[model samples]
Target chain A: MLKLQGIRAGYGRIEVLHGIECTVGDGEIVTVVGANGAGKSTLLKTVSGILGIWSGTIELGSTAIHKKSVERIASLGVVQIPEGRQLFGPLTVEENLELGGYAKRRSGRKAHAKLEEVYELFPRLRERRRQQAGTLSGGEQQMLAIGRALMAEPRVLLLDEPSMGLAPLIVKEIFTILGELNQRGLGMLLVEQDARLALSLAHRGLVLERGTVVLEDTGQALLNNPDVQAIYFGQHGGRRDSRTESA
Target chain B: MTFEQLLQYVASGLTNGSIYALTALGFTLIYNATDIINFAQGEFVMLGGLSAVSLHEAGAPLPVAFAGAVLTVTVVGILFELLAIRPLLRSGVLTQIIVTVGASLAFRTGALMIWGRDARPLPSFSGETPVRLLGATFNRQTIWVFGLTLVIVVALQLFYRRTLTGKAVRACSINPMAARLMGVSYSRVVLLSFAVSAAISAAGGVMITPASFMSYASGSLIGLKGFAAAILGGLGNPLGAVIGGLLLGIIEALSVGLLPGGSSGYKDGVAFLILVLVLFARPQGLMGGRIVDKA
Candidate 1:
């Protein structure tokens, strides 16, 4: 339940996302796929209030959240698992997760409510909970980033490249986990450079080109589209995962 | 000097080190939270010492005097944050730095006018008795100072480890943007850092007064030493500051023991020289992490 209309965002003197329009429907998994520097991550940053927008509106549910502080936005139940796994390096795995649910911990009892479920979801994290987050492997850290966001019990999870730098097997495992979470009704906006995996796990996919949404389609439809095939899937739609086609 | 002499030196060093460590710990805490080297920290300590001495003379009991000193300086720290630091919240670190440094000088000069240009001694709350260990003798005052500093550091460690607010502060230090996203008021956290930093510094001043001479102008050297200790320990690590402070004091003491002029005139130079070499050798300091220079 998030919407961005004609949103423009950028770093100083360099605009990245130019007038981009996108939406995440309630309980739907929406994926944004583009090359590096296509503003995929920038769009997520703008939505999560890490970067301010230059123009346009970003709405979480019906409320305009762009003007709110990052903490306020998070309290409003929009949590982001930023690119690079950026877990608090010196803190333990559990501490990182504890901080993820900081808004809830302060203002209410919501954090305690999710503690059991979070531990259940990432049992390995619970096992090595006391270990420094920096010491965790890339896959573990990615899982931690996701788990940390989940601890927030966010209304909308904005994942910026959860699959980045992971081994192929680990990437597959993580995507499988995301799809499972989506089935359990977690709304997500997954940003990725990998078209095949994102499209496979998502209900709908949008292609970003030069910071603009260039293509939007149902997952299966995009998987078979000729132009999408040419640019991302290969002319023969070769890289489309067999599991997604079967599903 | 005999083994007793060396023990006495170490005892004094430990007491002195505790003061430095406690002061540096505050600096490190604030730096970790806000990434701004608060030059005004020494004034908080100075303010504490001065307040205690002033109130004690005004017929206040020792505990009451100490409490007044702490409250007075805590208010000053909060005021400094609200009035001085609040405006520079969105400004560059350089602006914050210059603004704070200016505040420290203003504060020190203000104290000079208020207290006059004289070194003042605080009455020992505990009766001044020489406590003996082995063949060495040192004042119970030194022991109390070191004890209090140890208590503060341990309490701080517990705060960071066992408390939610402390964990939130640690999280903020690690990632402010992330902490903000988690609904921690960015401003509130920064101010909290300031309050805690100032409170710790004030406590240091309180404990230190019974052990050493204090004057308005002395703020600079104390602040510099505290800062050097923080840098030596790694800017954010409290444990680092303690170790760094002890290391610094021992080195300075040894310089007195070994150097040509030694304590005659070279003691200050010893601290400065160690500071320089530490900056050159391992600039990150002991408790420092993978932090880049904000400057």
Candidate 2:
């Protein structure tokens, strides 16, 4: 389980998330849904220790991990699949996975088993273990990013916009796999701009408006809430397809 | 010049090229990790050779003196890394450049005060013996330079490829945040780079002291040649440094033998030619990266 209390985070000189109060129950898929600049990504980034928190406390179980280095936070079993599928482009597919398990490997753990686990999840990654990661398709890169995080054997996986810029079918497949992961007892905090997919896949969901959490509910309830639909979907529904709300 | 004479000139250039390669290793390694060219690099070489000569003359055995020389210069490199480089890492690239350039100036001035403005050479550890290979006579010293540079490059290649720490360094070079997330201490890797790079440069100085005498101001051109070799090989590629060094050497040697009065005055121009021409064609270098990136 992960908890954040009054978490204020930002980039240099510009505050992104004013103050966030969020929680993820054990083995639950908790989704943070919002607009493009709703600070959803910033929340995950602050938790992952990439962006510094100005006034807040983040806890991984009982450990106060707000001040821990990014690697230390990761070793505590919190792995992040960074936004934009930031795989090491020049490295081979296998190397990207190996780097993901870097901290675990240093303490004399077996990387091969983890590597096998990753390959099991994505057979394409195994097929192109020798190929450069940069050469992979965008959807494949997203799978690679997820597979890379899985290589760490994380207790809590934080995925940011895994469906970003992907085809409809590929996004569905990725979301389906994520549902399977949640069903298999892996806890996740998924941050997505797509409310429909994120809400359905997660057990509970939090709606972020601007930098604040506007609402929190069970996935089914949020799916039916008109307030959730009006603000998040109010503008896009008029221009883009309203069917995206059901995606 | 006769074809045979031209070949001999290239042969001499090869010897000089090895030394340049070693010096450039210092520049390339530091640049790879921190992206700052440590102008003080040449001082490490000067200190190593001069220290060996001074220690030898003061009654130490040659091997012991060489060891002390290497250690002394390595410590100096580490000190510079700690005092001059580390504090300014987050302080902008231009500031870091100016700081390192100043450190090199300070070190050279300090050396001038200690050793005076005199060129000194250490007795070759392997003796003045020469061996004939393929009709070209080579001193035992030239063979040491060639063989030693080869050995160091091979050893470093293995260290980077097979060892955990070296891979960590490579990872850091590629992505510092990811490397840190993997628990690689950024400071430790940067220090190690300076240590290894300066040690190689120091060894280079000692190796060539038998043929090319050492002076405080001599480090400037030596550093330039090394930079050229590193650039030609690829700014950050270790194997490139070796290839670049040898190429620069052969070119310089050929120039001297081919031109009338070229050997005496044309050596420096040969290295410049390679540097200018290589940069003109492939500025990213043979390895395809710049010495500096857009800040």
TM-score of chain B in each prediction: 0.96, 0.95
lDDT of candidate 1 over B226-274, digit per residue (tens): 8887777777787998888877776666666666654637777666776
Cα displacement (Å) at residue A140, model 2: 2.6
TM-scores (chain A) of the candidates: 0.90, 0.91
lDDT of 1 by residue, A109-227 (tens): 65555765788877888888889999999999998888888877889989988877888899888998888888888899998767877888888999888888999999878877777
TM-score of each: 0.91, 0.91
Candidate 1 recovers what fraction of true contacts?
Answer: 0.76
lDDT of 2 by residue, A152-220 (tens): 778899998888788878999898888887787899999877777788888899988779988999988
Question: How large a fraction of the reference contact set does each model reproduce?
Answer: 0.76, 0.28
Second chain of candidate 1: TM-score?
A: 0.96
Give the per-residue lDDT of model 2 (tens digit) for B10-71.
Answer: 66776788888888877888887888877777778888888888888999998888888899
Mark the regions of model 1 whose C-alpha exceeds 4 Å error after superposition.
A106-113, A234-247, B254-264, B286-295
